[model samples]
Target: MCYYLKLKYFTLHGPLPGMPPQFLLGNLAQSGLLFDKASLPEAHIAFKQRYGDIYQFWISSTRLIVVNNLNDIQHIFTHRNIYDQGDIYVQKFSIVIPHGLISSKGAKYKRHAGLTLPLFRRGKIVSNFDLIVDCVDKLLIRWRTKSPQHVHLDIVQQSQNLLLAIFGLIGFDYDMETLDNDNDTNKNELTKALQYFLSNFNIMLFSPKILSTIYFKLSSQYRQSQKTIEQYFDRMIKQELDNGKELIAQRKRTSLIASLVGSLQQDEEMETNKSEEDRKGLSRNELLDEMRLFLLAGFETTSTALAWFIHLMSKHPQVQQNIKTELSNNNSQGLLSLDRLDSLVYLDCVIKEVFRFCPPINGTVRTLTVDDRLPETGAQLFRGDQILIPFHSLARDTRYWSIDPELFYPERFLGADKDHHPYALIPFGGGHRQCIGQDLARFELKVIAARLMQYVTFGDGGNQVNSGGHLSKLTIIPKHVGVTIDFDK
Candidate 1:
């Protein structure tokens, strides 16, 4: 009776249907969010089926209206002012990177986005083709060291190393040497710090606010990780600022750090006229936060996607062959240049299909700023309500696809579903606050994937190990990606 009364009290303003929430526990106890009953993606899919496209989800006392409909999502995404940064997402990321674009709001977010987005433009990313190719080739060489008879590879680790190396060089012009066996303490320390931070950050997201705060304050590992990250990024910032004037004057460099530092330099030069509120550049602390965000985002998403790609390729030998054949027809010398990579159109479709099939990010959350009604379902949304737009749900919805959304076919992009609704396959998300580094992520994935297909064939390690499942963390990664690598002469 108390539960019913409490629920009724909360639902006075038009309630959306959802499973009954337990006192204090909300729906989490039954939602399987922190349990083994179902992965996050699976749980969401089940929720959509049980409660229809639009429903209410409670994480503890916080209410999130989960919307799976494409039209509503499109509306929410299009109206940037109505649906701003997600409360949970911002709260979670703010603890680690308060001034970073992911966590910061309003002026701070605008400042970071203005200074940062230009560095990731498609032209700039394309220009780094040689650098990316070099990184991928290093991985290929490392893989080649293994004998074909004992070629069962841990692709997850390999992908992480490859992406880390690429992003390190591209973002900061720093050589992490993650791909090599270099034992530089500083490099390895950065790697360890980043891993520790991410793992704990994920934990904090699942934990209650007070518990998360207590953990952050008391955890020695967390403190150490924070210290290491600060020290390393400070050093990078100082190095860039030391050469900031030259970098800005030349305007030839395109590394993320350089661009950010150049902004700072420009800000300093023009500080006499402009007020602090109107300043275009980020502060040193803000720059450090952004760097941390970049390093984590740059490697984590792409690496997880690559892991899934490897797992999928292992299961689909014919798809691998098709990509290889496309590459062959494009480049006879087996070289993976930017032009060659672009010419492999089928491979492009495959990459898109990979994103559509199992996106690294399952959903993007948006917090409502005004009380409004959803266009399709007519569910009333209150101010401060966070709505989750599930990308996986949209990708799999039968209404959106002409080809069966259940089937993982790359050719779907080439045929009837070629002109699928723009909102139907938003892996990087939509709207103004969509991923700033999407072009870079896509370019890196294509380059690494193409280079891998050039010299290696990934074979299924069998159902015992190669069975498909996802481990939900910062990204949806393949849980079992054991694959045999065959090197082609």
Candidate 2:
């Protein structure tokens, strides 16, 4: 026998004790189907009934071990060394976009995350509430004009514009005001790039490697769109570098890019006193990478979450009414401020519940770094083995959440229930590798949701809202949604 045969004999000696494979597509046919129409709750229900809490599934040729039990999730997240960040999908993304925090793994991830973390410190986020409120006010102004008309608003577009405005203000100190203009090129290109990235999710279901390669090569439009995105940032970064001194002198600025560039420059100056060997600062490309990630990951994920929140609110009118009443009773003027947003318990519950109902990233894959057996299942997994955790399925598992897993109930997230198992609700993920932008994203959602509720009354736009056939490259997003926005005016 060849060396390959010897390795197979050593590694794949016996059948794993879990759900039997489904010939070709494996459990993916039942679980990994298109997101837009896929009933994640139903899929989890079926899996729980058939294969128990822990089961084995396959997507393409890759084997996935799904875990619904909270203990399993805690074990997986806490043991970061054993479960290193998965590189299969990140490697594919690096081909099309520059690798940054989201794609970088291991020590590189650690270093970049450290550098980026200080920028999003709680104080900075609190200080920047006005910038967020400003963007929301612009959106509210636009909504007021369309109110009472029962406009069939492309909510996805609206949310994208609102997020882009926030990104522009913070990322580059460029006030996009995209909501004012419907045909802005920069806004359009950003939206298109996000859509392309979203499409990559399902494209992975078919043949990720081949499709990704083809997408980078044959799709000239996508390539150009990406280039446009890069160029836009490049110009903004260049402008900042050119005017850095003046901006720095202007004190008390809230822009994220301003803070980053200032921090880098300060680090560079401080490095001058140290030995050349010890001096380390971000290069031009590194700065761009950080900015790109902030714009792309920051805006895209927040926009998608906000869109889903609105859609869910529309479907559940009572929840919307409760939210409205809560806001009405409270002073709407100061509610958008960070202090007030932090105090809004019900608002926080609603946002958390939205995440439970529809997590932006359905699942994350991690490759095993050491040969080990799953604690609960006792199944042997070798180094280089890939494990998939489907958050979409886990969040709605009836075993963990008893209150009609599919329903949108914010109360389930409040009070004592808030202290439920860590893994039970992982919208922002768990452990050290959790999303870096969680706090910022949550703040953005609360500020936006609170402000919008103050001015507009969301209603079912006479169209069924479903997260079917949803695609995800980096984050999960609704495909195409049309909702009616009725203004409170």
Candidate 3:
């Protein structure tokens, strides 16, 4: 038909080159994304080599232009209105969390962000230092009981629990107590619901929207999990609303739910004190969606990062020693204060290198609002076209780094690559729409990493198990992270 010919020829025009997409599969068959030969990050690098920085690729019926060049990436990220959150990202997240900040845009996004953003400000998150350290201590205690010969074959699971516990306590003042659970078998209803959401989110993401909707409708297990999550969050929100005003007046430490509750209280008071239209804040449903978004984003990305950090430290013993050396030099013993944690400059580099070497999320997507041209590559873009800004490609691109980009050297942050390009190593991404909880994530990683260094050392459990590679999930996690946890004298 004429439509097929138009899609084949017209879609590939405008100086952009791409592998010819097969009838329905598009480039999915050729891109190695379907098969497990290479992870998405590796495939991104490979595709860049073949098609240059700006190349069109098809994921089934949808068209995506992979922009590997930093100049173009910077432009896209900086101009927020022109390059909004991608349709794919929005469509996928909106299925479950339409009112949540992640799936919203324009005025709705701004309204939600205005109230919630302050809760995650550096000052507020830093004050939760004690709670974060307490969670880390619980993990340290659990790890101390393990025999020296017992290879810590579950770093991923341990990290997930630690983060989930921390997020629960900090965000909602509700203790997940995941650290206390022996295994996932003992997880509570809320925990099970959360697990169900995370475990099956990728499935929904990859499926066609209509098909995913059908699946959601038909699956009793899915409906039950959603209902459980909604009830639990609703209960918590109500509890906070009932008791939160006094806490707000007392000027207590801010938990996310508490802050939202306080904001909602003010909105209620405004309705009474002023005209109906003068009141502002998120509705109950909006608050629930936000909480769900917080839970998913808070634990998922950071937990994967922690797992990768442990895997890397296990392989590089010298790097572990260097961290300990940094801690010792600063006299960072016992429970560390924010000031003491801040003084570990080398530890900062190691975290940066881990993120650069293997970012948790492979890439972020943005969609064009209007037709535009790339500043560096001169590639033409059309309205509604989606562009993939790969974090892995940008970090590993040789053009941006003074030293070899391939090496997993943490020292790169201190030496030749100290002044690397701004967009070259965006683990949390860049610009206005970047990960809002970045500061919280960084703080959690630093506190946990510093405490682990102070108490224990991770040793390589041999190549058979600890061989480095990644498993692409909501976040790209280490597929094989077997490390031996040794208690310090």
Candidate 4:
């Protein structure tokens, strides 16, 4: 917390404070403190120390304002009427996911969010818990025969397999045998498509036009991946429409996409007497766009969270014991009753701490709808300017937490940090647009973590193999996560 002056400079948008000399490289693609890929969450802290909570990373025409303050993020997100998710997101992402909840604006956003929400409601998630855990059991069975005791498993690959299988079942009523098969090149088409698409979607979106022309010429694989995924959606949506009400009974227990399809089918059937223009059914392309976004968000977030949880548990044996002890006390005969999972208070704290420690989606961007001022620094901003709320900085700011923010202690939730600022640790974000699948994500994490702790012990695999860093892409995934798991009697 060094003393820094609030230096304001005039831009086309308005008066805004720019970054410090340390971030003078002024490159959003490389050295941007807010958007740096190599730096993970540390970049937010570095900029906060140099320029404080609110400032712009003004690189020429770019007027991206970075806000790490709780009040500021709260204000921006809470006032959804005033400020939407931002046009940059809509303009860029909508090209891929048309009318998707994240990409849709205003009324469309509300309609999509409201419609898809029931599928992720707490009751729906609980009833579907066993269905979700089916994938986890398959993964555990595979793990048992992978190698001998004290073997290092590439958790990055394992998590990808597990989540794809889980989401496949939940989302499409399909079985993706990514966990069973050993072949890489001949793996599931949807899995391959997702891996390729998420890895390259942003690059293709933001690259310079001339360079993008060159990129498209050279990116045959990327084009094929997108086409493959899109084709699958085309077939599914066409099948649902050409056939009729295939998944009505399992709508509540299935993926959000399934529910959407079932609902849309009902809408179409009810409007049989209406004109084509008056039909309420979602068009094929629109539903496909949402399906792509749903799969991308669904599989990535929970898997990344579980991977981090396993890594942390391996690092801190005591925390694992605490979770296991809680599970043992339940005396439940089954894998995990909803009541038993609910009672694991300590595991809940660990889940929260992991989200704070290393969030999958580090931060989100918003566009100002009207001229506004950041109250803390009094920096003036204009309409259409981009604002970034770095979750890393908010979670790490010592001022908001009673305990040290740098520590990996989950006990803080039960003790000193109990009263920590609500907006300080928003892994799934906050306000109206917070992650709709958070309840599902947390339930999945707890059930899997509890099962793992009950059946096995994570042995430290040493720094050489378990080297810690992160890969910042669609999600901030662990770049180096290798841990040894041994089954317990």
Best by lDDT: 3
Which runs of model 1 end up more than 4 angstroms from their true locations? 1-13, 151-153, 182-187, 242-244, 248-253, 264-276
Q: Write the residue-wise lDDT of candidate 3 on 82-193 in tens digits.
A: 8998888778777888778888877767777877787777988888888888999898888778898788787887898899999988888877878886753576777678
Of models 2 and 4, which has the larger lDDT?
4
Name the runs in model 2 displaced over 4 angstroms: 1-14, 17-49, 147-153, 183-187, 204-206, 245-279, 330-336, 463-474
State in Å the error of residue 173, model 3. Answer: 1.0
| Comparison by TM-score, 3 against 4, better one | 3
Show the colliding residue pairs in model 1. Answer: none
Model 3 deviation from the true structure expressed as Cα RMSD, one decimal place = 3.3
lDDT minimum window of 10 residues, candidate 2: 5-14
| TM values, all candidates | 0.92, 0.83, 0.92, 0.86
Q: Which scores higher on TM-score, 2 or 3?
A: 3
lDDT of 2 at 159: 83
Better of 1 and 3 by lDDT: 3
- Backbone clash pairs for candidate 4 read none
Q: Ranking by TM-score, best first?
A: 1, 3, 4, 2
Q: Write the per-residue lDDT of candidate 2 for residues 1-489, one digit (tens) a residue.
A: 645633432222245535544434445565655443444434555676677766665554445666666776677888888888766556555655444666677655665565567656566676667888888888776666664645445776678778988878766777655776653334565567656655554554434456557766787876776687677777776767777567744532455565556546445456557653454555455566677678877787899899888878777888888877777666755344555667677888899898887788767767778987777766677787766677887777777775777777899877546676668888877766677788888888888888887777767665554433354545666655656777775
Consecutive 10-residue window with the lowest summed lDDT within model 3 = 263-272
The residue-by-residue lDDT of candidate 1 on 334-395, one tens digit each, is 66666777788899999999999989997888988898788987788888888988888899
Give model 3's TM-score versus the native structure: 0.92
